[model samples]
Target: MGNWESRLYSVPPQKLGEFVQNSLRPFEDCQNKIDKTVNTICAVLQEAEQFPLVISVAKGGSYGRKTVLRGNSDGTLVVFASDFEQFQDQTKSPSEILHKIRDVLRVWQLTTELAAQVEVQMVSGTLTIQLSTKRQSITFKVLPAFNALGLSDKPSTWTYLELKRALDQTHSNPGEFSVCFTELQQKFFKNHPRKLKDLILLVKYWYEQCQEKLKYAPLPPVYALELLTVYAWEQGCRTEDFDIVEGIRTVLGLILQQEQLCVYWVINYNFENVTIRNILLSQLRSSRPVILDPADPTNNVSKDKMCWQLLKEEARIWLSSSGLNESPGLSWNVLPAPLYTTPGHLLDKFIKDFLQPNKIFLEQIERAVKIIRTFLQHNCFQHSTTKIQKIVQGGSTAKGTALKNGSDADLVVFPDWLNSYTSQKNERSRVIREIHKQLQACQQKLDLEVKFEISKWKAPRVLSFSLKSKVLNESIDFDVLPAFNVLGHKNSHTAPSPSVYSELIDLYSSSDALGGEFSTCFTELQRNFVISRPTKLKDLIRLVKHWYRQCEKKLKQKGNLPPKYALELLTIYAWEQGSGTTNFNTAEGFRTVLELITKYQQLCIFWTVNYNLEDETMRNFLLTQIQKTRPVILDPAEPTGDVGGGDRWCWHLLAKEATEWMSSLCFKDGTGEPVQAWKVPTVQTPGSCGAGMYPITQEMFSFRICRTLE
Candidate 1:
């Protein structure tokens, strides 16, 4: 009755243990590096173990690591990956991967231990066996789907070439195959161990027979993919993964000089399709762990639409394969998690692990430094030694955040230095504009490939910048804030509104941080982000291309929008959305943010403070929308002017300028009219003023003072 996780582990992969600790690129969280390291470790483990069960067992212990095993227990193991979706709806759980592998191993371990007594009758994708002394033999292999647990079996025929001169090689007993297998298993553990090569050879005859029987006719491209997917097993387990070179050859004729249709052929294609069914029955008979197609969505509204597509496509391709046209099939049923197991979500736990920096995070500090080296080269457009560190903030994956279907990417931009700029609020606007420009160009022209944009966000009068780039097919967003040294406290870094941090994300991305250093395709930070976690996990990583968009104003106003903040939001939404997270649960993680934001509410409020656009001059014009109160995602719940009003902190800071405006203290000499917040005239406060405002100053965009009163 129990499900996959409750079952025992599969065989462990041989850990290559050869990974170099990767550096954390400044853009990446330290914890993410740990996840990557864990995954790589698991990948290596999977790599070393050519056996079917080894992959399942090892990946379960690692993060974002999964092995989808397909093959008969008595035959060879074929390993593939489960989907890596953030909303969980599209993929399998790390824990589930581990549990299934463990269960597979447990069954094999126990079965082999009992081998002396139980006989191994057949070794197809399924296994059959009978008690050594009994007339009946049972065969079993793991099934892809099953509602009930325990055992199931089927009868099959085996005909060997009748020998003329030889003594009887076939056992005389009706169920001798099972008995001999059992005897072999018992002997295997007792001695130092039957060498693994010999164990593999034991199934050689069966492998050939299975392939010969199933080989059929296939179409073109499908045949190529088959060669990529299946032909390697014919060689050795060491060559399991896609050989890009070979894939290129198979798909594009092995010549990189030109992009064209492939000339490759599926010379020795075999059908592992029906064999899968056969193995399923065998696993059932052996009481092996159940296998499930991960793309099927659970009760979670997180649609498997994406995953289902992948499954169907794979199935379709396999069916069209040269040797398996008759076996055309599709998802019959996707069983719910097995019975007698924990109902709690393991991904919830995985996200929970991200709430804070653990010891693994320390490893990333080192990684971050390295990432800086890589990213800095491209980010040097601003030309300062300016460095950035990763800071955690609140936010969410696109899913479950709002009416929007999925979570959007938010990147936190933290600078190592540039305390001076945080002091002056007016300078931030110009700085951010230039930073945005530099980054936009950096991504296109430099090794960093980072494109960025910046725009005005008032209230607390914070600036917003969005960074985007591509890896594979998806666009990645790096939402950032620009601040000076003023806000550099633990948990919150304050800066003058025109801070240097986000500015550098732009500059370095262009000029390699102006050191004009090494050119790079991806900053070390970007690489680690890619390496540490899979962007394909979900669309949370879906966008980051151009910061400029049709809806920039609308996007930032909806949330605080800091990268770190958005990340927290993702975890919260993941909890709510069910890995399948999203659609309606918008405020899922606000409670936690409520506690954390109190300390930085003033700053957060600052982000909300916007200059009034009421334009009392034009009675009830622009004010119409502002006055129409509705529960909107970005709307301040109450007037930001008061503490009880949501976003009050932002109004509080802006109110200082309002008071100055009301007192007629904001008039500047150049405007010849009353101003709100700008350099006060010398006659009013001369000593406090800097050099008179010029038409084209660096702070023109940030402060926006001196204008001809048109």
Candidate 2:
């Protein structure tokens, strides 16, 4: 077996427990010595003559929490002074306080009886005093704090606000104010069960080994690891007695996901207070690996990306070495980040802030579209018969669901000569080449800078180029695809005649191409399908599209996944089936879509609003399409296209990601219960429809058809 397997087999559970008891635990003698040294330091600080401003001394750090390991001599002493009130304004630096405290310690060491054995010095801006004797030496770090939390275990909102204001103004280290709440920091861990403490010790021991192995390589703070261990136990196994190895395994699993790790506690401060909530939200939204100090909102212990990378690398090795992969379900089911219940208003704000394009961006897009439309209407192609009939804008820009900074427009160019599907398919390539040449040639005449992606294919279908001008912050990309105008100038409210779909089915069946081959022919209909939805429904579509883009970025290296249009259609289906109202809970709608994605194998959704089961040929073709495969999402505008049904795309990867997101905080509410997904079925059946189903036209079939073949 491997090294991890061997190491695990060699150490039985009973033996591991005994090892912790003997090797990791501090002996009574060492404990007594450390306590005596602590008492001596407190006594020296209590001297009123040497330090009149000092009020009281409180123990902090691991020593204060009673979780210190054996032979660890380091400790923190928080000196709260009544006269340091002026420093609370944050106008004065913390070094001034440290210097004042250091001067008093210096005077005492020189005048005290143990002057020969005691050494006082300054280290890293903190006052350090080493008490050395014949047996051993103990080091104490003195930190002067404002004592923000005066006498209560739970401080008031006003008290925290004052502290937050001071912290925000200070130029010093963010954690400098953390000392002010040292008691809360100590109490955060002091109440844990004995078994949980042992888990912390085990994790800390593992961390120490990694630090020794890496030597000079930076790692996240040991305190952050301690908090991570506590968080794991609290979320995974809250009981006092739990399996030690399982706890270790869970922590290691979390460490491996350090890139997305965002953990915090609401015990000390929470989102109820407006000021604190804003601060917490901003902190949570920052770059990953955000481990907020439980006692101090301003401190993020795991902020260094390079350090987290180093720690994650080491964690991968140790986790593999533990030989726990053989045991499934050994680790706890914990998400790296906490669940955030987004209210409707907050989700709306999020869409406006992050997803929706601003006025200026829309204006720029319009200007670019105008210029392109002008060119398509006036410019001539090389072929005498290849005159442009019309150009229609499609895609997210037309549907009003485009995201910020993602600027692109799809301009479907319909040539006059390509009247039939066969002719259009044959002549579209030559038309695209002609357009590409003319676009490059007319840059000077149009007074616009254009850049083209030099295509390697000789018969490219779409001519892709970007337009640059002074009015645009970024170049707007445009895709000019020449297609057959099968619909001509049909009314937006009217569906195409059955003959249109009948012709498409016949042409698609005769060719060796996949479905959606002639989808561009019905661009106007496709745009109208989504553009006419409720405003709130469109917002939901935007949210779903944003999520799909994120998944695309991550899964791009694996292979081609499902198209974003499939997800958009699924969102529309979910909203139609779940709640047809103009306003609904966005999170619920989002959850419903993700839940459907996870069950992609059962998705057989289609909308009969634009096409129906009236015509015999069209009905037979759709029945064949839906029955061909699972995940059959027939394009509303084109019956031949099954956007969700394709063998080339990797649907399983998207399903896997959706499953993980189901457990994320995004799906959870303020009460910590999972936000309920709509009661939408995975497989859309004809019998499942009620009044909420998309309204069918009077000319359509009276009976609904089941997804299964009769």
Candidate 3:
């Protein structure tokens, strides 16, 4: 065993709980002293004659939330002033109010009855007054803020609107008005279960240890860690008397994944009003580690990525220490990104804002595609017997579902020498090698740098490379796959005859080929299948793709999941079966697709857009393919391709993630009720099954298959 494992096993599990109980408990005397100190400060600030503009003084921060550590005497006091309500510019007005408060503190320290006990100083160029007591030497930070929430516990929509307006005007410091919502911030934690507070204290203590060890490096604010602890407890173990060590381990594990953290709560504000909804979406879509302050939507407590990085380094060390036992699975199953209870309109706006590539990016992609086509036609196969017949652009870029900042192009190179599926399969490696060599030879002529991803397979099917040039902001990735020209320079809108697929099925059945062996040959059909959809349907596809990518990033460690193309086809199928109209609700469509994924065991989806189902050869092949696996999404363009079949895919992981997402805010409506999914069937029922080329048994399949006359 490792050092951490040995050290961790030395301590009994019950002793860890006792350690938390004894070492982390707050002292009664210290609590009494801090309370007296806070009362003294509030009483002095409320003196009517000395401070006229000061409306009320209240304590804030960890002390106000009752989650402060034992030895930590740090506290914050927010002084609400009447003048702040009328102040037009926060950049100037808050400074003026703070100056006045500092001036009063300077005078009161000398003239007041508690003169010798207190020392006050200004914290230069900001709205903070640092006060220290001479006896215990406890420090307090005082600030003046506008009373945005007033006496109401639940802030109104106008309150959020006013806060949003103030935030928008003051981009220099978006969190300038955070102090105004001190009460809500305090209440956010004050009302939680007492054991949750203990978890926060333990997490705070751990954070302090990190600070002491890494004093030179910056760390995320203690408030961010505290919020993270609360989230861990709520999501992982919400009982009153849960395990303390488990809570610490979960938080430490979460800190390691800080790059993906995008947490927020809907207690203070939600996506209801249009202005607040847009603001919330914009905030959520910001850079990583976005732990939005529950009280103030404008304040992202964990905005600095570098600080999180430093803390994450410390977390890794501690996670391997004796306290955590180095167990990774002890952490919560919470997703780092918060799923918002988005409406259909808001979902549309989110797609437009976050998913769709800009016009310039699209144009650049098109230019890159043209350049690649030119390279393939003129330069790639110059010295070989196999010449380039035609190149078709595929993947998301060709289908118009490409995401922003994610640029990829798929070029299906149909060689003239390979006329059948067998030749394309057997001779693809040589063709790939020839194209790779030619690409290196003509690299300087294209004025672009190329980097190839070395394949582990001796005869890899696809040639993957990245191109870097001054013409693009970022590198564009290319996948060059060699396939036979089976459909042969036909119009993409037109479907192929049954003879095309008949020959393909016969070729595939006779050889030791995988299901999607010749899928690259039908790239044009695959692109056209999606590219011909309505604009809104494409937008929905983008949303589904975005969700699938998130799941892929998270579940990659488990095993290989389904390909992005299968989910794309599933989305198209969902739209076709659930809502065939050009305009449909995006949230409902997204929900329907996720719901289908959760029921992947019953999934048997396909389309007849490019192949004729009436043909005996194609129909029999599809029926036999669908009967082989539970998740049977056949490639619409190629009859032999069951894109979701085989033992290679781990659908259970995706289904587990999908089940969790169904309960998240993403599937919830504005009223906090679950958004109903569209009435889409898990299995595609055939109108009528043709006569017995393949045997169909009731025990083998759940759905019925009729044997029609040939």
The residue-by-residue lDDT of candidate 3 on 384-456, one tens digit each, is: 5657889888888888887654457688998888899889888888888887777766655664233234233
Worst 10 residues of 1 by lDDT: 15-24
Candidate lDDT (C-alpha), each: 0.25, 0.73, 0.72
Candidate number that wins on lDDT, 2 or 3? 2
Question: TM-scores, in order shown?
Answer: 0.22, 0.54, 0.55
* TM match of model 3 to true structure: 0.55
Clashing pairs in 3: none
* Candidate maximizing lDDT: 2
Point out the worst 10-residue segment of candidate 3 by lDDT: 688-697
Clashes of each: 114, 2, 0
List candidate 2 segments past 4 Å from native.
Answer: 1-299, 302-345, 382-385, 447-459, 467-476, 670-673, 687-704, 707-710
TM-score-sorted candidate list, best first: 3, 2, 1
